[model samples]
Target: MKKRLWVIYGMLTLATATWGSAFIAGKFAVQSFEPATVAFLRFFGAAILLFPLMWVMEKDRKKPTLKDHGLFVLLGLTGIALYNICFFLATKHAPVIKSSLFIASNPVLIVLLSGLFLKEKITRNSIIGMAIALTGVVFIITEGHILTLFQYGFEPIDFVLLGAVVSWAIYSVVGKVVLKKFSSVESTTYAVAYGTLFLLPFALAETSWLDVQEASLTTWAAIAHMSIFVTVVSFVMYYNGIKEVGAAKASIFINVMPVSAVIMATIFLGETFTLAHGIGAGFVLTGVYAGTNPNLFKRKLKGNIVKNKTA
Candidate 1:
């Protein structure tokens, strides 16, 4: 049993590395395409690859239903559609690591949101972790700008990344509820399918389809990589790992992604570390640790909120 647990952990860690690099990979692709067009094509590309694969794979599973249609569209819009748009836009302005760290805040946000909705207790550790993580994010965001974010020449493109983080958190929480009715694969497949079609109008209208002849070999390779590895393989591995280990453990693995993003971005995108980055890393890691133990954050918050409610 212990060995199996370790294996699952290994798989999750590897998958996180892959996902972490996804931003860098997209970074490479976005150099040629605008974030919107890039976001649009990524879904279309994934659908072209995975839609057929799903039929071959699912073979006899029951087809999805009407309720599923609604849920799948919502999934597509929130998870794939909006998430990619925000991510591509963000990655363009921010270094891959900073962009990734910003979104990595999701684990902490999930805890707070889940506590509110699911009645999960927030322990002191969780609160401390979240505080530490937020401090890291601010330090990193300011690039250690203690006083003025304005000094950093505030780029709106980065805020798009912030939007992506919130969209994804919502996607994760809501998707979990939808998953109760559909298998993860089913939900994923339909979400991908709907997002592809949903995005098709703008994708075709603006993409300059004739440029297919002019696109360089490198661009083609990136598209293929994004389609197969990032879209298909990563999602499959994540689903597989989640099945093998519980979701909590699976989530912790996601925290590893920022490290990979930072490493890859530094090498690939020429990003660097400042003292602020060091401080930010501490905060982010602290937050991840805080999330691991919820008991500490909850005990304190419970009394305060209860008192506030009664008062």
Candidate 2:
């Protein structure tokens, strides 16, 4: 049991590391392809693999009704299509590390939206953590010059990146609804399929078969890495880890993502890490820890209380 648990942990770590590397891959891919074209190729490849995997894994699952298809389409739009388009666009314009930091703060936005749409309770910690996380995001966006934000307003790319965060939040919230009807693998496969279809027209507008054929090996390799390792393999491992260790424990591994992204961006992209990025990362990770582990302080308090009573 211990050995198997360790294996799960290793898988989770590798999964998150691959997710982090996706930033680097996206940067490389967008250098050669249009944002929409890059997104389309990545998901098109992923959809090809995910469909067969879903079929094999979910043979016992019931067929989706028309209503379920609607929900899947929503997931496809918000999570897959919109998120990736924004993601690639942001990567094209922003430093991969900075863009990744913005995405690292995604859970805060998700929590906020959950409160509004899903009626999930927003705890005191969640609110405080969100404030801290947003502060960190501001610092990252302004590059330590918070006053510049007031003077100049947000850059165009900031809104594009925020679009990615918002779309992902919507996807997660909608996924809660979809999960009630279908397995994760099933829903994800359908969503990817639909999302690829949605991107097809946009991709067609952006590029031709000749452009695709003319793309460098680096671009194809980046797309393959994102599709195979980041999308399919990591997702499977992450959910499996969640199943084995529970969501809270599994979520802790997400902290590894931004750290890995920063390292890869530095090494592969030759991007310099600024002091502002360091501070922002600190706050963002701390805020995510506090927000996600809502019961952490309560548990510690209970332990202290019991110890005091014994004393």
Q: Judged by lDDT, which candidate is best?
A: 2
Model 1 has how many clashing residue pairs? 10
Given candidate 1, what's the lDDT at residue 78? 77
Candidate with top TM-score is 2
Regions of candidate 1 where Cα sits further than 4 Å from its true position: 1-9, 56-62, 90-102, 118-162, 239-254, 273-290, 293-311
Model 1 Cα shift for residue 61 (angstroms) = 3.2
Q: After best superposition, candidate 1 residue 26: deviation in angstroms?
A: 2.3
Which run of 10 residues does model 2 get worst, by summed lDDT? 242-251
lDDT of 1: 0.66
* Candidate 2 lDDT tens digits, 1-311: 76897788788778887898987898788778888988889999999999889888887998788888988899889888989888877867876445765676676666666667767666776666656656665665566886754454457798889988888777767776666567767767888889999999999998988887789999999999999999888866765664555443444556567656766888898988889878977876676566555677889999999999999
Candidate 1 per-residue C-alpha lDDT over 190-300 given as tens digits, one digit per residue, 9 for 90 to 100:
778787776667566766756565667776677777777777777666656645543433455566666566667778779896677677767766665565544555777
- Clash pairs of candidate 2? none
Cα-based TM-score, every candidate: 0.74, 0.78
Distance (Å) between predicted and true CA of 173, model 1? 0.8
